[model samples]
Target chain A: MSEEKRIKVLLAKLGVEVHWRGVITVAGMLRDAGMEVVYIGNAFPPEIIETAIQEGVDVIGVSTLGGNHLTLGGELLELAKQKGVKDSMVFVIGGVFPPYDIPKLKDVGFDGIFGPGATQEEIVGFIKDAVSKKLGK
Target chain B: MSEEKTTKQILQEAEEKRKAERVPLYNPEALKQIKEKFDQWYNTKLREEDRKNWFVTPQTILGSEIPRGLLYTPLDVADLDYMQDIGFSGDEPYTRGIHPNMYRGRLFTVRQLAGFGGPEDTNERIKFLLAHGATGINIVFDLPTIQMYDSDDPMARGQVGWCGVAMDTVKDWEILFDGIPIDKISVSLVTHYPTNTAILFAMYLVMAERRGIPWDKLIGTVQNDIIMEEVVRSGAEYLPPKWVFKNQCDNIEFIRKNVPRWNFITYNGYNLREAGTSGVTEMAVAFTNAIDTLKELTGRGHDVDWICERLAFFWDPSMDFFEEVCRLRAARRLWYKIMKHQFNAKSPRSMWMRCHVQTSGISLTREEPLNNIVRAAYEALAAVLGGAQSMHVDSYDEAYSVPTEAAALVSVRTQQIIQAETGVTEVVDPLGGSFYVEWLTNEIEGRILDEIDEMQRLGGIVKVIETGWIHKKIADYAYKEQRKIEEGIIKIAGLNYFRAADVKLPEIDVFRYPEGVEERQRKKLQKIREERDNKEVQARLDELTRAARRGEPIIEYCIECARAMCTEGEMFKALKEAWGTWRPPAYW
Candidate 1:
C-alpha cells in the first residue's frame, strides 16, 4: 500500500435516481482491493465530478440503473471535460446498460464499461490497469 | 352416551378417528437404518468429489433461519394436526386453501400492473392487455400522483408521467378508463397513503356514477395500506400516523356500507420483501399492520367480521420456490387463527386470507436480461402453487426502467403460458401433501408468529414504525443481503456465478417515454382547472378541511370534492393544512 502506487477512485450515481446498491458494493470491493474510494451518494448532480478532480482521483466510476444513463452519463463526461479533468481521470460506467450503447459511451471517452453483474475482480482489475496505463507503469 | 355430544367434542373425535387410521410412512428403526446407510455411502463414495467439484455449502431455507436437510420425511411433520393446522381446503384453519376447488375451479386473476406517461398512454396499454387476455388491471400511479401532487406543480418537475400514469383530476381518470368496462373487470390501484387513496376511491365512484354503474357493482381494490408505505416503501407520510389510521378506517367504513364488493384495503408485504426483508418478516409485518388497522376500526365501533371480509393481502414470490409456497400457505393459516380465535370472527369468509402476489422485482438482473424471463416464470409458478388469488409477473426489463409494451406483453405471456400450457392448475393444492412443504409451512408459521409476538411486546406495529424499529430492521436485512451476494454466499445466476463476457451481451430496445409528456400533462391539468367551476371546487375543499378539523370521517367530504372536480393536489393541500405533515425519523 505504498502512497505513490495506491489508486484513488471516486464512485457516484447520476441524476435523481436512488439505485445505490451497486455503487456501494463496488466501493467496498475497491476499498478491499487496496484503493482509496470516495462515494458520493445517490442521485448526485454531475458537478461532483469536479470534486473528484479537486481530490486528484485517478478514476471516476459512475453507476446508474435509471434509463437516464444516456442523458445523465453523457452529461457527466461533458461536465468532466468542461472542468478540464476529462483527461486526468479514467471514466467508468456501470449498471443496467444495454450493450449496443457501449460503443456510443466509449466514443464519448468512457475508458471502461461494466454492466450489471460485473464482478469485483474485473472492476478492481480494470481500475488497476487503467491507473497503470495512465501512469505509464 | 346416546345424548348428542357437543360440536367441539364431535370435531375432536373426528380428528382422533382420522389420526388413528393414518399409518406411519417409515418406522423408527427403518429411518435410523436409512440414515446410517446414507451416511456410509456419503463418506465412502461421494463426499470428497462432491466437495471438490461443487460448492456444497449448508443451505438455509430462504427467509427462514432453519437449515435444510438433504431430505424431509413424515418425521418432520409428525407434530402437525390435520384438523387444527392443515385443515381441508375451504375448511376451518384453511392451510390447504381458501376455496375447495382452488385453481381447478378457476384460474388466479392475471392482473398486469401497467401505467406510464399520461392517462391516454396508460389507457391504451390497458386496452392492449385486455385484448391480450389479461383478466384484471392493476393501475400504477406516477410518483407525483402517489405523493398527492398535481402534474403541473413545480414539485413534480422531471417526475411527472415517468414512473406511472399521471392523474391530477377526474378528467384523467375518465380518460384512463374511457372504454374499459369498469363493472366487469377487476381494477386495483397501486396507491398508498390516506388522502391519495381517498381521492382515487372517490374518483372511481364518480367515474362509475358517470358511466351509469351502481356503487355495489364496482369490483376493485385500492391499496390504502399506509403502514407498509411508512415502514418500507416511500416512507413519506403526509399526515401523522393517527390521521393515517383514521382516514384508512374512514374508507373501510364507507366501503363496508356502500361499496360492499370492493376491497377497501389491500395489506401489502410485497414492498417489504423488495426492501430486502425476509419472507417471514414480510408476513409478520403485513399481518401486524392489518391487526393494527383492525384494532383501530373495531375500537371505533366497527365490526371485525364486516371489515375483514373486504381486506386482501399482497405478497412477493421470490426465487425461493418451495419457501414462497409455504409462506403463503402459512399466511392463510396464521390469518385464519388470528381472525377466528383472536378477533372472534363469525363468518368463514372473514377468516379467509385472499392474496395477490407479484414476482420479485428485486430478483431480476440487468445482466442477461433474457434470463429474467426464466426467473419470472419460476416465480409465477411459485405464486400459483402458493394459491395466490391474483398475480403480477415482473417484466425482464424492469430492472432498467418502466417496462416497455413488448416487455410487459412478455410478462403477461409468461403467466398465460403457465396457466394455459402447464397442467399445474389442474389440482387443488397439488403440493399440499408433500412432507417438506407441510413441514416448512409450519416452520414459517411459527417464525412469523414469533415475530408478531415480538412486535406486540414492542407495543404493536404502530409503535415499532413510530420508533423507526421496523425501518432499521429492513435496512439491516438489505445490507446483509447485499453483503451475502458480494461474498458469493447467495448465488444469483448470471450475477455471482456463470458470468458472461461483455461481448456476448444482447441488445434490446428499452421503453422511452414520449418527449413532452410532462408538458402535455401540465396542459391537461391547466385545462381542467380552467374548465371546472372554481367556486364549487373551493367550497368542497373548504368542507374537506372542516371535516378534517372536526375529527370526523372525511371520505364523504372527499367524494364531494372529487365530484366538484377538485384536483388531487387541491384535496391533499386542504388536508395537509388541516393536519400537519409527518417527517419520518432518520433511522439509519
Candidate 2:
C-alpha cells in the first residue's frame, strides 16, 4: 500500500448481543487518524464478518454481549483461520467478560481483547502497531 | 331509541363501515417531514452489514411479525371504542391508564437491577437504593442460582457470584436481608422456575416468622412464570409441556395459599422483545402464555378471579416511543377483554393489567455510553405513559458488567427527574385522547389478537414455543433489523448517523462481588449437609418427590425440604428427573 492509501477497516457485531459502543469509538479514532472506515452494524453471525474481511478490509473487529460469547468468538477465529486470513487481518474482541476470562480469550487467537475500561488511544495504537508490523514502514 | 349497541357491536360495525366523520389525519403533516428527512439522511438504497445501519425493506420484513409502523396515526386506531376498550383511568380494563391518580402524588418504583459478590454485597446495594428513594428492590441472582445450582455444584464453578448474588440455602437469604425489613418494601426477583423460587419464598416466610413479621404484610413479586421463561429462554426445552404447566399450577396454588399478599407470577415479554422480536410478537406471546396459565389454574378448580388477582406481567419498553405507548395501552385493553368477556372475571383487579417494565437492554450501545442514558430516559417515559406499575431502568454500563454505583444512581435519578421535574404525571392517561396514541394502541391490539390467534391454532404459546415458532421469528427480525441498520436504512445516533467524537464519560463506581462469597456459601452448604437432620432432609425430599408424582400441591412439600436445608439444585434436579429439561430446536 502507498503512503497516500489509507487503511480501510470494517467493524461488525454478530449474535443477539448488541454492544457497539467500543467499535464506534475505535471507528472514530481510525477516521481521525486519516484511515478509511466502515461500521457494518450488529448481530451478524461469523459469515458476514468473513465477508467484510474478504472485502479486503485492513482490520476487522467484532463485539458481543450475549451469553454465547465463547461459542461465537471461537467460531470467528476458526472461520478466519480456515479462510487463510487469520494472520492478515487483525481480530479484536470486546464487551462484558470477567477478568480471568482474558487468558481463554487469548487462547482463542483474538489479536486484541479490550475489556471494560479500554480507551480509544489504546485501541488505535494497537491497530497502528499491527499495521506497522505488516507494512514494515 | 334504536338499540343498545355493546362496544363489540360498535367496533365491528365501525370496522366494516369506516363511517366516522373524518378527523384530519391524527398525526400532523410534520411526521411526513420527519420521515422524508429520515429517508434522505438514511440513504436506504445502499447495502451495508450493520443491522443498525441497514434500511428495513418490505421483502426482508417478517411476513407475519413486523410492527406496522414506526409512528402510527389516528387512522390506524379509528375503529377503537374509547369507553369500552380504553375506559376511564382506574376503571375496568384501565387501558387508558391504571389509576386516575397515577403519578399525581407518587412515583413508580425506582428499582435498579443490582447484584455482585454474595448476599452481603447485594444487601448493601439494597440499603443504598432504599435510602436513595428506590421504592422497591429487584434482585439479580448470579448464574449459579439462576440455573438452580448450589455453590458447591460443579456446574456452578466460575459462575458463582458473577452476575448477581449467590444463595445456597436459607442462611444466604438471612444474610442478604440482614437489616432490611422485607415486609415494608416491595421485592421482585428475576427467577423463573417454581421449585427454587417457591422454596426461596418459603425460606423468606420463615425469616419473617423469626422476625415476627406477618405473611400478609409482605408485598412483592416472584417470577415463577415457567411458560414465559420457557418461551423467552431456549424455548422451554427442558421440561415436558405437561410438567411445565403442572409446575406453574403447583406454584400458583401454593403462593395463593401460603403467601397471599405477593404476586404469584411475573410473566415476561420483556425478554422476548429484548431478544429482538417485534412489539406485536411480545404482546401476543405474553397474552398467549397468560391464557395458558389461566386454563391450567381454572381447570384445577382455582377461581378465575383468585388467580387473576395474583397474575402480573413484565414487559420491555423499546425505543419506539409512540409504538411502545400504544403497545402498553393495547396490553391493558386486551387483557381486560379476555378477563371480562372470556373468563367472566367480575373483580376489577382481576381485569387490571398490572405490569413492571425494564428498558430494552439491546438499545444500549457500547460505543457511546452517555447516549444510552438518553435512550433509557425515553424508554422509561414510554413505560410510564403506558402505565407500568413498577420499573427498573437498565444501566448504560450493563453491556460492560454489573453497573458501577454511579451508573445505577443516575439510572435511579432519571426516574426521579421524570417524576419530580417533568409534569408528565400531572394528568392521568395524558396521551389517552391523542389521535395517534389511541390509533396506534388499537392497531397494536388488533395485530396482537391476530398473532395470538395464529399461535393458538398451533395449540397455544407453549406449543408455538415447543415448535420453535417464537425463536425463528425473533431471529428473523433480528437479522432484518441488523441488515437495515448496516445498509444505512435506520441510523442509530452513535452507530450510523451523525457520528460523534470519541468522548470520555465520567468514571462509574464499580460494584465488585463480595470476597469469599462462594467459599463461604459452599462452607454453609457443607455445614447443612453435615449438621442438618440428614434423615429429615431425605424424608422431605422423598415426600416432595411423591407429591410431585401424585400431582399433589408440591409447594408445601418443597417448602418442607427448604426447612430441612435441601439445596435449590438438589430440589430442581429431583424434579428434572421427573419432568426432564427442555431444549430448543437449533434450526440456525
Model 1 docking category: incorrect
lDDT of 2 by residue, B431-486 (tens): 88876677667767888887877777677766776777776677656655655555
DockQ of 2: 0.07
Model 2 bad stretches (over 4 Å): A1-95, A98-137, B1-81, B234-237, B500-510
> Each model's DockQ?
0.17, 0.07
Model 1 residue pairs with clashes:
none
TM-score of chain A for the candidates in order shown: 0.90, 0.85
Native A-B contacts reproduced, model 1: 0.11
A11-81 in candidate 1: lDDT tens per residue? 77664343445565677678878889887654333456767867888998887654446666777788888
lDDT of each: 0.78, 0.70
- Cα lDDT, model 1, residue B30: 70
Model 2, docking class: incorrect
Candidate 1 at B492: error in angstroms? 2.0
Q: Tell me, per candidate, how large a share of the native contacts it keeps.
A: 0.11, 0.06
